[model samples]
Target: MSKHKKAAPQQRQEMSGVERLGLRVSSMINHPIAQTQRWVVIHRLDTDGEAEWEEVIGLLAETPELDLTFNDDGAVTVRWERSALQERDDFIIDEDNEVETEVAAPF
Candidate 1:
């Protein structure tokens, strides 16, 4: 008889503290509100997350999709721009079928 083993090593695996902090950082920077509260994000990173500062910097630098931008106001924000998310001139249903869109812009 064969020995029984765990079904999945990664199934429902708990994230490490670093992973959790990374998630929080991602959410804060990616949120629409972050654009207006850039300083708040920086302040939190400086004070609350000071210990993990190096890890945070590594995450931002190592991530090819994430970009660190320094604003004129002295606040920094991270942004990710997926190539697939770029604006298309018209609506697309499928590879062969595209529907022209009438933009609501008055200009």
Candidate 2:
């Protein structure tokens, strides 16, 4: 047998902007400073563009885990609704998890 190790399968891919933002939000909530934080700040870079921001916010709004509010300075504040999140624990979408999509191959 050859002494070379086999290449690992390409299982991991780069995270999208929204996915990264989601992870950040999760981290903030779990952080110790979250105890007194009333608002979770999100800058433009978090979403890349206005359209991307809209899309990210739109997706989060659909879930009951968190609430998002826009600030005058163009930052987004995130509010976690623990009860709602607990209830949706069975299907919570977080940074570490990937949303599944099925695509049919074009013949």
Best by lDDT: 2
Task: For each candidate, give its TM-score against the true structure.
Answer: 0.39, 0.53
lDDT of 1 by residue, 1-107 (tens): 77987576666878765676667665555444432322123323434355565576666667665577656764455654434223333211133222243432111
Candidate 1 whole-model C-alpha lDDT, 0 to 1: 0.47
Could you tell me the TM-score of candidate 1? 0.39
lDDT of 2 by residue, 1-107 (tens): 99999998878889887677666655655543342332356666633756667777777677666678888988777777544554555433344332243432111
In model 1, which regions exceed 4 Å deviation? 1-17, 29-47, 70-75, 84-107
Least well predicted 10-residue stretch by lDDT in candidate 1: 90-99
lDDT of 1 at 95: 31
